[model samples]
Target: MLTDTLRKVDNLMKNKFTAILVALCFCITSVNFTGLLTVSAATYGDYTYKVSNGEVTITGFDDSVSGAITIPAEINGYPVTAIDKDAFYGCDSLESIEIPNSVKIIGEGAFRYCYALTSVTISNGVTTIGEEAFEECSSLENIQIPDSVTSIGQWAFYNTAYYDDETNWADGVLYIGNHLIKADRD
Candidate 1:
């Protein structure tokens, strides 16, 4: 009877150990999967960026940043080549932004819904502006599209105060070296 009781106790301990091991594994996996264990890339000034293949992409910004924000041309030896989707979305206190010449692409909704944004300086190297890149910027007064910009996605400047109908844009139209780019409705 003593041997039987010992065997039962040993089995119970083994079961408890197995359950604890399973629970630990699950917790670790959950943390990694939910990004709680991932480390963010370096932050420069008010911006955070991630680098891959020797290129940098702006990811997020510090919420306390107000007024004009200037994106640096390079961060940590990598050229800032792109702005990720929703990089500056809904930053209501940001009044303006200056994108450096190293940036080539502006991702979808990069600057959307910045209600207080009024001006933007897009340098000469940018080629593509993604969909809704500057949509819903009610206070934006004007923008100058550089000649290097080859494509402007749909609704990029929708709902802005400066938008005018494409055909009736006698004034307040986005221009690239005299070529009309967008004349969105106000």
Candidate 2:
């Protein structure tokens, strides 16, 4: 009878130990997955970005940055495919910027109110330039729109020196490459 009780106790202890080990492993695995999600949210230089479906989108920038900046084609091994609205808005000190070939879209007002922006280079992979993308870039005098761009939103270059310059117009129209920008109805 004593041997029988001892066997029962040993069996109970083994079962409890196994259950505890499995619960502990589950907790550890849960914590590890949570940590991976947090780690995925990262930054590239002064650019705030997010990754989704294996693509990266630049969402914002450091307001204090000055001079020229080149948006990297990839951030943290993910391709930078888009720029969010207002990403560089109010960057008064920015002089120039280059959008890499991996980017496909430029969100609305991406560079709005950048008073000191003078030059912009858009690579060939871009497909769309959003509304008010370069609005109020008062000092922007040089910009290039590649053939890959399929659309430009309303008021994209409003108030920009490039748009205001008379020499940039041909006949009664302003054009960037082969894309018709505006018409001088006057």
Candidate 3:
């Protein structure tokens, strides 16, 4: 009877240890992923932004404020380093924008479908313009893309006046600075 009782205790202990280990693993994963996915956001002036790694990323805009949208170099003391995906999506009143030199990454569809947007002046520090960043900006005709851009996502300038114009093409492709935005011929 004693032997049988000792064996039951041993099995019980092992099961409890296994349960504890599984619980600990789950807690560790939750802590790590929470830090990565739970970004705190704040509003500064016309921008709603998030801060990570001491830099600010613009995530949303106050659509009521329109025309000549000048993205500031910094927000609330942190340097504005990026623009989030779909940040200004469908802000039809936005007529123009000058992406400041502090910004490096422009997220996918960042300025997509801003129908009234007619001009864009990307600063020299910008490196990547995300997919469909300016897609469907029907009025967009004037733009100055700096040589610093290394990657531009597909349809970044599609449906814009600049993309539709043959004068902006070389032979068949629309080359913006040294980056090939689209190819047109046959």
- Per-candidate TM-scores read 0.70, 0.76, 0.78
Model 3 CA deviation exceeding 4 Å by range: 1-38
Cα lDDT of all candidates, in order? Answer: 0.82, 0.90, 0.91
| Top-down lDDT ranking | 3, 2, 1
Expressed as tens digits, the lDDT of each residue in 1-186 for candidate 2 is 999999999999999999999999999877745423432456789999988777888989997999999999998778999999999999999999999999999999999999999999999999999999999999999999999999999888888998888888789788878887777724
- Candidate 2 lDDT for residue 145: 92
Q: Give lDDT tens digits, candidate 1, residues 62-163.
A: 766789888899987778999999998888899988999999999999999998998888999999999999999988876766889888888887777655
Candidate 1, residue 105: how far the Cα is off, in Å: 0.5
Kindly report which residue pairs in candidate 3 clash with one another: none
Clashes of each: 0, 0, 0
Q: Which 10-residue window of candidate 1 scores lowest in summed lDDT?
A: 31-40
Q: What is the lDDT of residue 124 in candidate 3?
A: 95
lDDT of 3 by residue, 1-186 (tens): 999999999999999999999999999876755545446799998889998877899999987777888999998778999999999999999999999999999999999999999999999999999999999999999989999998999889998998988788888989766778887733
